[model samples]
Structure formats: structure tokens, C-alpha cells
Target: MTTVHQLSSPWRHDFPALNTKVHDKPLVYLDTAATAQTPLSVIRRMNDFYQHEYANVHRGIHQLSMTATENMEQVRQQVAGYINAPDAQNIVFTKGTTEAINLVAQTFVKNQLKPGDEIIVTEMEHHANLVPWQMMAQAGQLTIKVWPVTPSGELEVSDLKALITDRTKFLAVTHVSNVLGTINPVRDYIQLARQHQIAVLVDGAQAVLHQQTDVQDLDCDFYVFSAHKLYGPTGTGVLYVKPGRYEQMPPWEGGGAMIKKVILPTGTTYNHPPLCFEAGTPNIAGILGLGAAIDYIRNIGIDVIRSHEDNILRYCLEQLQHIGDVEIYGTPKTRAGTIAFNLIPHHAYDVGTFFDHYGVAIRTGHHCAMPLIEKLGQNSVCRASFGMYTDQQDIDCFIAAIHHIKALLD
Candidate 1:
């Protein structure tokens, strides 16, 4: 195991938000699971695009429009390469992970699965993954099967056989738990799901930012993640559809860009794969920023980033455990940098409120995973999530802040 300082990111200087002072205290942001702070590389790319190359993509015939469309489409290839997808044409841009999940549920899953068919999701899903399926199931009268989570916060893999049947139409599971930080055995799940002919969509929002994901290697049917969490701009995300599934799927929404031809009397034809789903004009500057962020992460190497996060997580786990009142949750076999815990005699919100006094930002409450948090028999918990910019000093300061908060409250 390496020391936290030894794993310190050389790229922290790329993020300007880390330099901000709140109430004269330097910011120690630890809520990256929600959204990551943007690197200047991403910011500059967006700024440059807006200043010089701004245009509505795939619609205009002029020079500015063509250049903007090329830049945006290049990011599609970049995303495909980032995830090692089978084809760049399979990558669909959405507002974020939520919209991506909705795309699958409405267009892909809805068209295929019928009433009384079953779909499996974990107890650990963020609402983005869970709610859309719940809505779809409610509408289609489909049965939603839950993959039970072990008390230790891992998915109950042994229960998979029992949950999946021939009637099981789809399985949408999170690659990593936002609250428990569990790096779930998703590959094994995918392998198992394949035998039963279940289409799997992996919610990669929390996992993609921390580690590299090769969709082709995993062989998942669909993979969705938000680019913002990868230190890119918000309002932009990716949906990577497996090669064969594109032919099976149809246009999700109707708009100008997704159309091939429109005849008044007879019919209308739709554009092919990627553009079929991207109905309207997209966030061009944000897409450029997303590309820049991917470049930033690639320059540093994901393996290096993972190693650094592992160091930080180990250090954080140790320091937080040393505090007596701390109740750390989820003893996972493998995990991410996001850690959840509760301070006895103090609610999570109160702890988070006090932590901010020390300029340490953390998330509190259910974190949009109400089902999982409620399953744990707690309404709220304090969550400290990490990113590439996080370091040893941040954890040290967080630990000190917790002690001070406990002492002050007591």
C-alpha cells in the first residue's frame, strides 16, 4: 500500500475550484460522486468553442456550423474510444445519465419487454437508474426483480440464479455503489445474465470517473454515464449501445436532427443510430469540454488515478475509523473513494453543516438512493466522495474537522 502523499495527483493544479476560499478557508471538496470540479483544460475548451466556433451542429451548412459539428462528432469518437465501444456510431449523447437511462427504458426496453416480464436492478442504484425502470414497469405492468444486497453492501451474487428466469427481459445494475462505494461484481453478473438472454444496462455514472470502462470488454448491452463526473461540463452524457442492438432499436424522440426525410402525405424517415436519439441541438461547448476532460484524464492515465484514489481511500478509511463515534458502512471486498458514515449523537446534515465551517464539502441525506439508505434503516448519512484532485491533506483536514465537530457538539 502506498502513502496518500505518495499517490498525490500532479494534476490537481488543473482545477481552479480547489483554490477557492470560503469564509477565509480553502475548499476541500469531497462530493465528486455528485459532480466533479471542472479542470481548466475542460473550461478553456468550452470557452474557446463558445468564443469562436459556436454553432448548432448537424443542421447548418455554413463554415462555423460544419466546424462545430466536426468538433462535436469527434467527441463521439472520443467517447467511443474512452469506453472501448464496438462502434462510434453507437454512442448517443444525452443530457446526463438520467436521460440516457430514460432512452434505454423508453426506446429499447419498452419496445422489447412486455407486460409481466421481469427486470432486475440492485438495491444500491441511484434514482437515475432505479426510478426510470420503476416508471416503465408501472406503465407496462412489468415485474421488477431486485438483486438483494448483502449486509456487507455487496450484491448477493448467489441470489442471481433465483431472481433471473426466462421471463427476465433486462437487468440494469450500477457498476459502483454511490453510498457504499462497492465496486460490484458486475462482470460476473453480466456473464450470468447472458446465459439467460437478459439485456443488461450498466449504470456507470459513479464508476466511469474513477476507473476505465471498456464496454466491449465487459460485453454489456448498454452502458450509461455522465461526462460531468469525469471532470467535464454538465448537461452532457453518453449512452453506448452494443453494435447489434442499434438495428433492434428505433428513434426515441422526434425532432429536426433525427429526421432523414419528411413527406407531408405519406411518411417520414429517421436518421441513423447516434443522431436518431440526439433529437435537437446539443450542448456543443459542453461536449468539447467533455472531450477535453477525457484528454486530461488520458494524459494522466486511469491506472495512475485509480492507484492514487486507492491510497486516499485507505487513508480515509483508517482516519475515519479512528474516530470513536463514527459508524462506517459497507465493508466491501473492493470499493471506490466514496465513503459513507454516520456520527452518533449527530445527524448527517448537522455533521455536513459543521464540516463546511472548516471548508470541507460533503454530501448529506439519502443522496437519491433512498431505497438503499432506507434498507440500511437510516434516513440519512454523511458521504465523502473523492476525485483526482483530492489529496492526503484533505482527508487529514476532514478527520480534524470531524473531531472538532464532535467535540463542539458534545
Candidate 2:
């Protein structure tokens, strides 16, 4: 592992929020797992759209609308390339990862699920992946089976094999555990499900920004992730549907943009796959910002970003372990971008509140992974997640804050 001093991020200056202050102290943001601070390029691109090119996409023949439509469609292609999807037509835009998963649950799985049909989801899934399938199970009289995680926070392939029966129809799992920071073997999971003819949807909200995501390589039926986690604007996400999978899914939402023809009393004809899934006036400015975000990552290179984050995570883990009182969770074989832990004899919320006073921003609580927390025998934990811009200085600040908290609370 590289020393923290030898691993400063060259891209720190690109994110303006690093200079932000709280209680007159420079903000040490370590909460990328929740949402990353937007880079200047993404901000400028969104501002440029609102200032000069505001228009409803795919609705008007006017110049502004045409320009917006063209730019949005280009971004659709960019997203497809980002994940190495089979085709641009396979990408569908949504509010975020939560909606993307829900979109599939409602359209693709809902209609196909029969009573006694089983859906397999891991215990480490964030609520976004778990709740949607639970709702589907309730509505369709399906069974939700849990693929248990080990105490070290890894899913055993044998456990998955046992859970797969002839009745299993779908598998919804996370690419990485947002709480445990464990990078699951999604490829293995997908391959197993493929053999059984079970559809798979990978919740990629925590994986995309930290690693290069190739949907085709993963060979998943559906892959979902949020743009905000990748330094783009919020309220924008991508759902990569396999070529065969999209052809079978009906429109989850119906409106003006998704429909080709609607004869009121007669019938209705829908547009193509991507458009059919995207209803109403989409987030044009946010989509443009997402495009800029993709360009920004490409310019820096995902390999560079992943290496930087790896160093930061390693340094953070070492510091936390050295503290002696800090109880880290999930000693998985491979982890990335995030480290979750609890300061002994101190509540996670209290530690987080003290951290904020020192301008060290982190997330505390269940992290939308209540079941995982319960499985770990912890009610809540503090998470320090890294991004492309995280550097040694931020880690130092966070370490100093931890010492301060221990001194005051211990």
C-alpha cells in the first residue's frame, strides 16, 4: 500500500466543495457513498444549459428544443458506452437507482412473477433493492428468499447455489455492499442465475463510480446506478437493459414522450424501448450534466480514479485500525471506496455530530441497510467513503477529528 503523503489526488482542485467551510473550518468530506460533491465541469455544463439552452426535449421542432433533444440523445449513447451496453437503445433514464430497480420490478418482473415464484436477494442489499422486490412478492404472491452473508461480509457461492431452485424466477443483488463495503462476485452470481434461466438485476449504485462498469461483461439482465454518485447531478440515473430483456418489458410509465400514437377510444401504440420507459419531460439539464460528468471521468480516466480511491481507502482503514477503539466492520477479501466502523462505547450519531463540529463530514446510522446492520449486531455505524478528489489531507482531518472525539467522549 502507498503512503498517504505519497498519494495526493491531482483532481482535488476540480471539486470546489472541498474548500467549503463548516464552523469556520475547511470541510473534510468523506461521504461519497451517499452522494459525491459535484465537480466544476458538471456544474458549469448544467448552468450553461439553463442559461442558454433551456427547452423540453423531443417535444418541439424549435431550435432550442432540437438542440436539447440532440444533446440528451447523445448522452443516452454516452451512458451506453460508459457501461459497455450492447446498444444505446438499451439505456433507460430514471430518477435514480431506486427508481431504476423499481422500474424493472414493476414492468419486467411483476407481470412474469407467479404465485410461489421465488426471488433471491442478498442480506447486504440496500433498501432500494430489497423493498421493491418485497413489494413485488407481496403483490404477486411470490417468495423473497435471502442469500445470507458471512460474518466477514461475503456471499458464499455455495449459499447462492442452495437458494437457486426450479421455482426461483429472479435474483436482485448489489454489486457492492454500501454498508459493509464488500465487493460481491456479481459475475459469478450472474453466471449461476443465467444457467438456471433466472433473471438478474444488479444494484450498482455503490459500484459504478469506484470501478469501471461493463454491463456486457457482467452479463446481467439489468444494471442500475445513479449519476449523483458519479459526480453528476441528482435525480438522474441509468438502467441498462439487455437487448432481449427490454423487448419483453412493457412501459412502466406512460405519457406523451413514451407513446407514438394514442387513439382515445380506439387504442394506443408505444414508442421504442428506451423512450417507452422514459415518460414525461425528462431531466434535460441533469442529463447534460451527467454527460459532462462522464466526460470528466473519462478525461481523468477511471483507472486513475480507482487507484487514487484505493490508496485513500487503505490509508483510512489503517488509521481507523490504529485507533484501537474503533471497531471496523466487514473484513472482506476485497473492498473499495468505503469503510464502515463504530467507535467503541460511543454511539454512531454522537461521533458523527462531533465530526461535523470539526468539519469532517461523514454518514452515520443504518445507511439504508438496516438488515445488514442488524446482521452485524450493530444498530448504526460511521462510514467514510472516498471519491476521485479525496486526498491525504482530508484523511488527516478525519483522523484528527476521531482523536478529538475519543478524547472528549472517552
Candidate 3:
């Protein structure tokens, strides 16, 4: 493994929050999986939009509105290019990944699934992916099936195979487990669903930040992720629907921006799928910031960032293994840059509080995957996730804080 100092992350300085301190101590941010720190480039781009070129897009004929509309549309193209989609028309902007998944549930799933049809989901899904289907199933009298998780926090392929029957109408799963740091075999799973003629939707919130994603290569029916996790602004995300599915689905929401003609008494005619989904004034500045964030990632090279994160995860795991009374979770052959562990003598929340005193930030609790946590026979765990700008010192500090907390507890 290469030393951390030898790793070149010239873009580290682009994030201003890293240099700031909390209580006069340097802040060590280890919560990138939840939300990443935005780069200065994205921030500056959004500021430029508000300061000089602010206007309602696609509504007015004025010069400002035209310019805003052009920028917004160009960002949509950039987003499509980033994910290797066939065209920009396949991308639909939304509030975030949660909303995108809900859109699919309401528009595509509701339209196709019958009363007895089943939707298969894994035990490792966040609530955003799980609850939407569960609610829809309840309302429509559809059945919800789950794929079991192995002891190592991976989905059992055999179990998944057994669950997929002719009754299965759709399969939704996460590309990466947020709490377990497990990298699921999404491409293989999609292929299996294809064999069964089941549509597949992938939750790419965690995977997109750690690696490069190509929707064409994955061959999924739909892919969704939030920009906030990718060093971009909040209130912005994307849903990528295959061209065939895009044409088949109905509109999820109804409002001014989505309609072509609204008759006063009798009927309303809606626009095409993407615009029909976006009901009103969209988050134009947020999308601009996302575009800037994509530019930053491309400039720094995602491949290089992924390599660096892999090395850091390995180093963090090795260091934690050396410490006494620390139990690590999710030992997958392929994993992301998240580490979930527990101290023997202390609750995970207590451990988190101790780390806070040392200015070390980490997440604790069920991590929104209550079913998986119960399956692991643990109430909660402490998590430390990595990002492109994370360094060896941050990992060392986290490990030291854990040891300190353990000593006091013991």
C-alpha cells in the first residue's frame, strides 16, 4: 500500500470547511457518507448565479431568464454525461434521492404492478428505498419480498435467486450499504433480474461518491442519487430512467411546470415525462452547484480518488484490528470507505460523545437500516466514513480517540 503522504489530492484545499476548527481544535470530518463538504468551486458557482444571473428559468422571454434557462439545461446535459446516460432527456431532476425513488414508485411501479404482484428488496436498504415500496405495497395490495443478508453483511445470492419468481414485478436494491460498508454486486443482480424480466432500480447514493458509475454498463432500469453526498449542494439529485421505461411511466406530480395545456373545465394535457415530473419552479442554483461539483470531481480524477479512499479504508481497518476490545462489522471481499464498529464496554452513542470531545466526527445509531441492524444482533454501531479529501492523520486521530474512549470505559 502506498503511504498517505505520497497520495496527491490537490483538490483538498478547494474545501474551505476543512481548515476551520471547532472549539479551537482541528475538525476531523468522517461523515462523508451522510453529507460531503462542498468545494469552493461549487459554492462560487452558486454565488455567481444568485449575485448576477438570478432569474426564473424556462418561464420568461427576458435575457436573464433565457441565460438562466440555458445554464440549467446545460447542467442537465453535464449530469447525463457524468453518469454515461444515452442522452440528457433521460435525466429527471428532483429534490434528492428520496424523492427520485418515490417518483419511480408512484409513476412506474403503481402503473405496472397488479394487486398480487411482488416487489423484491434487500434487507440492507435505507428507509428512502424501503419505505416507499412498503407503503405502495400496502396501498395497492401488492406484496413486498426481501432478500436475506449474510452474517458478513452481504446479500445471499441464493436467497435472492429464490425470492425472484414470476410474480416479481420489480427489484430495488442499494449499490452500497451505507452502514455496513458493503459493496453489493449490483451489475450481477441486475443481470439476474433481467433473466427474470424484472425491472431493477439501484440506489447509488454511496457508490457514486466512491467510484465511477456508468448507467449504460450497469444496464439498470433506473438509478438515483443525491448530489449532497457527491460534494455538491443539497436540494438537488437525479433520477436516470432508461429510454424505454421513461416513455412508459406516467407523471408522478401535477402542477404548472409539468403541463402543456390546462383546460378550464374538462381536461389537462401534460408535457413529456421529465418535465411532467418536475411540477413547479425547480432548484436551478442547486443544479448549477451540482454541475460545478461534477467539474471538480472530473478535474481531480475519480479513479485516483477511489484508489486513495481504498488505501485509507484498509489502513483504518488494520489500525482498528490492533486495538483491544474493538469489534468491526461487515468484512466483505469488496467494500466501500466506511468502517462500522463497536467498543465492548461502551454504547455506540457514548463512544460518539467521547470522540466529539476530541473534535472527531462520526455517526452512531441504526443508520436508517433498522432491519439489518436487528439482523446483526446489535442495537447500534459507530461509523467513520472517508471521502476524497480525507488523509491518514484523520484516520489516526479517529483511532486514537476510540482507544481513549475505550480506556475510560474499561
Highest-lDDT candidate: 2
Q: Distance (Å) between predicted and true CA of 60, model 2?
A: 1.2
Error of 3 at 98 (Å): 0.3
lDDT of 3 at 334: 91
Tens digits of lDDT, candidate 1, 151-263? 89998768888898889989999999999999987889899998989999999999988898989879899999998889998999999999888877788798889999998
Off by over 4 Å in 2: none
- lDDT per residue (tens digit) for residues 307-400 in model 2: 8888888888877777979999989999988999999989999999999999999999999999999998999999988888888999989998
Model 3 misplaced regions, further than 4 Å:
none
lDDT of 3 by residue, 208-269 (tens): 98998999999999999999999999999999999899766888788878999999886999
Candidate 2 local accuracy as lDDT? 0.91
Candidate 1: pairs in clash: none
The C-alpha local distance difference test score for the whole of candidate 3 amounts to 0.90
lDDT values of the candidates? 0.90, 0.91, 0.90
Root-mean-square deviation of each candidate, in angstroms? 1.1, 0.9, 1.1
* Candidate with more favorable, higher lDDT: 2 or 3: 2
Error of 1 at 52 (Å): 0.9
Q: Each model's TM-score? A: 0.98, 0.99, 0.98
